[model samples]
Target: MTNTETQVPLARFGISAVEIARVVAVFYARVRSHEVLGPVFAAHVADWPEHEDKIARFWRNAILREKSYSGNPMREHVSRPDVKAEHFPLWLGLFHDVLRTELPERTALQWGALADRIGEGFRTGIVAMRQPKDQPPKLF
Candidate 1:
């Protein structure tokens, strides 16, 4: 519960390209219509189709470690000042919801765990990236 630590959730394991694509597609559809997260995405992403493809590719690479994606996701999110740590749960929830319905129970649980870990990492990075200007720096 320290200031430097965050709530880390457990995750599971990978998947196929088509399944990954479906997960991304369903998840983004919910995100686009989400009241809280919709605006955040819309503000940063102008092209939904392109963004969706990149995201699908990113997930595919992350899950399979296929080395297909090249984008630095941490840097991308950290650069967005409007993105807060609180938003991770909302995004993760939507992702899990879509996975459960579109995928098998085991598949959903595995990806749910993976998504949780990813969200935690992203949140931690975002918080660290947003440290106050006057805060003392620490090497950890």
Candidate 2:
């Protein structure tokens, strides 16, 4: 079977809270230093520790389904005028890189898939938000 035909079992390779914290820490460190994404993130996130913790909560909720993430991520991303659809790919690419470097293959793939979906959703939301006021709203 082709690689695409193989299904990754959802519950088999779960990430621990410590792993999540590690990923978040390393990932943001890279992001903070990146040429393309760094300035954009720095402009909005004045407090790194608070922002990192919030992001960890987001990933914890996403990967472990812990229900700890309460913020409206799409709304938050949309509010950042410097954030464009073009940046989402950069962000996701960085995320994928960190996951591959820090995690086992199956674990990285699982988290990467979830990150991709979230990135796509954020991209779509940002694009829809950019549409002219007269245009009909895109389905959420």
For TM-score, the strongest prediction is 2
Candidate 1 TM-score, true structure as reference: 0.84
Q: Against the true structure, what is every candidate's RMSD?
A: 9.9, 7.0
Report backbone clashes per prediction: 1, 0
What is the clash tally of candidate 1? 1
CA lDDT, candidate 1, residue 118: 89
| Candidate 2 root-mean-square deviation in Å | 7.0
TM-scores for all predictions: 0.84, 0.86
The 10 consecutive residues of candidate 2 with the worst lDDT sum are 3-12
Candidate 1: tens digits of C-alpha lDDT, residues 1-140 = 85238543222254677888877888888999999999999999999888888998887777876567888999999998888888998888888889989999998898888789888999888877788878875332
Instruction: Give the residue spans of candidate 1 off by over 4 A.
Output: 1-14, 133-140
